[model samples]
Target: MGTQERLDPQAGVGTRVREPWVTVVWNDPVNLMSYVTRVFQEYFGLARHEAEARMREVHEKGRSVLSSGSREQMEIHVQAMHGYGLWATLERSDG
Candidate 1:
């Protein structure tokens, strides 16, 4: 199966549905786990437990999906993460 396409009523043309984009934070050697968790909490407004879980995922799995939304929002998130000294990237969601 594949993603569904939709017709834009106004434009009267077919367009692929917009897929959500995700901001991914990658593990790095420089930042401490505690710091990463704190950043996740502060920037993403995530609960303490949730932030800690994501931090652990980045530590063990090499990366973690921090947020999912429009591509522009994900870009903003990636930029914020860079400002905070965390490695991050954005990509289309698999779903």
Candidate 2:
């Protein structure tokens, strides 16, 4: 066996190392799309069109990344989303 391989078989292999956490806003039966859009605009400072686009993405795609960062930040976003009566969660990306 080569010296490089002896260190550990996985060590020499390339892999994506960044941790990606996302604040996912889910589709809900109660909140209106317009309200969701407004909340996104208010919290994220996104324009009306941008907010609406994101909302539509959530409705069609089942979820949208409302924010992304460290676990702490994602938690805050998820909590805020809940306060607005929207379903949200934080998940670490598998990639």
lDDT of 1 at 70: 76
Candidate 2 residue lDDT tens string, 1-95: 00111333557764433446888999988899999999999998999999999999989989898777767778898999999899999998654
List TM-scores for all candidates, in order: 0.83, 0.78
C-alpha lDDT of candidate 2 relative to the true structure? 0.83
lDDT of 1 by residue, 1-95 (tens): 12347898999999987556899999999999999999999999999999999999999999999888778788999999999999999988886
lDDT for each of the candidates? 0.91, 0.83
In model 1, pairs of residues that clash are none
- Tell me the spans in candidate 1 whose CA falls farther than 4 Å from its real position: 1-16
Worst 10 residues of 2 by lDDT: 1-10
Model 1 scores worst on lDDT over the 10 consecutive residues at 1-10
Q: Which stretches of candidate 2 lie over 4 Å from their true place?
A: 1-17
lDDT of 1 at 49: 100
Question: Which pairs clash in model 2?
Answer: none
